[model samples]
Target: MTSRSRPPRLRPLLLTVTLALALAAAGCGTEPAPDRVAGRSSSGDPAPDRAELEARASAAQIVAEHVWVTEAAGYALARQSVGVLGDDGFGSSYTAPDGGMLQLSVERRPHAEADCTDGSAAAGGSEPLWTCERDGEQWYRATESGHAYAREQGELVITVSGAREKVDRATLRSAARAAHRADDHELDQVLPPAGDASGRQPVERGDLPPMGDGAPNNDVGASG
Candidate 1:
């Protein structure tokens, strides 16, 4: 009986601790359902569709002084201009007098080079007789016959789509080359040699020629 009396004081403290824990658990238990419902409602916000993205891409424009070139010589001959448009806009346009004028806009990526490379000269009957090159931030031009005399120069860059499902640079280069081959009447033989989209073609990631000092020597094959 005496020992039972001595244990009585600690029982009150244990009871208080138990009561606090029970209250906290009860407070936390019932609110989860309501919180989850609120979170779900907030998370269900809608996002922009495909059309919106396309529109945004279209609106972005170049705003800088661009160096454009129209080369009319060599294995790679075409007239095209590439320039830095402002801080964001970058575009290139090409024209073949007898054929069509095709223009393409360059997409901007963080810390990327504006690659222009040694393009093959426009073969005989080729619509465009000019070739252009853009590497890093410079653009150059040469005449069709000036290619051998002008030398091969420019950079080839890889352009990947958002999903990486399509390669724009490869597509553009291939189409350009195809146009050249068609003019030369060597389309079937030089191109379409049994290759799928996944297969690598002639235009691998080629390196751009080193930029020499002074103005680009475009005075090849001058009419004296």
Candidate 2:
């Protein structure tokens, strides 16, 4: 009887088939899909609701009012001062009585899909402004040409900036504290329509002059 042996190519093909079968079996034994839906995670945290997001957008008005130059601790609204609320942000500026200048602003955007943690101005080399907490919210402040504080609420990040000699960390934190959710009617009155041409131009951190010994231009303005 002739000795029987598999062809070398046939052996390789058999090995390949075995490997493919093993892989298919492994896949078949994998865990089932998570029992969740509609932007929810396997851990069961649902994405923010549309109405909730709209409410947060309305709350941008609170940041707008509280972070105005006129809202500074020792400043009054100047004649040339301007404060306007756009659909997504607010900006205000004023000249102090002693010739100093103060500009305060706040902007809001929807939370991103990944990483919704509150950012810090210290990341830009400025220092933290306050050391307290309210209703589980911690406020922060940093300096560039001025001072600013930023905080994150459920689905919104609010930042308040005050630029002037007298604008202190405490004042900025207070401004942060004053920010609250505003009602729809209030937001409608303060914020311009989505396509309005006349509104206070958003004052970006870069728009302000750089601080002395500029260490990174303060994260408040740079970070959204």
Candidate 3:
């Protein structure tokens, strides 16, 4: 799909909301300076390995494009979405067309990140990190609120009460678009079309962080 028409793809990774708040509380260095990926070290200071950097780059692109989060509450609850960062950033998440349930896709890249990480690392390393199913791509970092994840994958095939229902792809898109509009209305909320301060752009790769890799205090049930 064209970048403008692309679905919202970056919100699901916001599963790190708790940690982001904690980082902010600890005065974690002023939100990574907009263009910078706010990575921290074991000491809760900014630090990331090559892999982490790439993951942020991927996320930033997702954010720059039509980043959105999809949510629904009902018997037939299912969520799906797509988003693009720029010329090269394209990614999508959806329930499986078949019975497999949740599925995600993106192009290839240099280094990658997963959507979830086991929360056992130090403060800096403990941020909810994303992962790439593939490797060998560019790298960078991102700064976003965990609660803003665009897609709620865990609910792709959800059961409200006693009935099972799939997420409505159309509904998901609607919510995402609303979120973008909300961002637009807020001051100092717009992300630059180009890469963040790190000078990285979005990549066309599907990467998620390893499960349980984020801070133990965080819950990734939504993006899972």
Candidate 4:
């Protein structure tokens, strides 16, 4: 004479809920991998290896190994100018307080010791009093007003250049000496995230004809 009511059908529903809850708990227990490009981090860590750099760079469609940074005595990095050069090369500029500019360029190309005269044409219109010398592994090239130090490390060519009027020769040399591949922290500070929507996008003009060579038609129509 035991009149035991059958267990409530709600038991099945309770079991399902419990299973889902367990799964969610399990998922929450596991931590996500740390993000290396999440802006400047306070943690002191060593620079990442080439394989890691390649992964990070590949995500941003650039060459990670090409990203180099240098510290000059009084020059500060121009954050806006830290950008990719041709294809996957790296280029950045530093500015001094007195309106001086120091440029750092890194590229993956075989660099043979060439006479400084070969690059003299880069000076510009007038011929500059050019002087070239070898300082250790660096090819130091100097004009009457400006100077640049370029060195080859493996498959990369790193150069530090500045105007003599503002940045001193010693400062430029110091920077070149310090130039090295960027670490994870530097990468975070220098490069914008891959496909960062927050970045400024190129403005789309309605007048642009999306045909031909895609050049803007400036053939002056009626209005000057």
Q: Which of the numbered candidates is closest to the native, going by highest lDDT?
A: 4
What TM-score do all the candidates reach, one by one?
Answer: 0.17, 0.35, 0.20, 0.61
Order the numbered candidates by lDDT, best leading: 4, 2, 3, 1
The TM-score measured for candidate 2 stands at: 0.35
Go through the candidates in order and give the clash count of each.
32, 0, 56, 0
Against the reference, the lDDT scores of all candidates come to 0.26, 0.38, 0.28, 0.59
lDDT of 2 by residue, 103-173 (tens): 33444554333222222335555644322223235434333344445555444455544543555566556
Error of 3 at 107 (Å): 15
Q: 111, model 3: CA deviation in Å? A: 26
Model 3 TM-score? 0.20
Candidate 2: where is the Cα deviation over 4 Å?
1-72, 77-87, 94-96, 99-104, 110-136, 181-224
Instruction: Put down candidate 4 lDDT per residue, 1-224, tens digits, no spaces.
Output: 98522111111122323332342333421321133322234467666454654555666556766778777655666555555666667766666556666777887665344445443443555554566677766777766656678887776778787666666778878888988877677765566555552222235886678898777777776877
For model 4, the run of ten residues with the poorest summed lDDT:
5-14
**RMSD score of candidate 1 (Å):** 35.1
Q: Is candidate 2 or candidate 4 better by TM-score?
A: 4
Which one wins by lDDT: 2 or 3? 2
Worst 10 residues of 3 by lDDT: 155-164
Candidate 3: lDDT of 4? 24
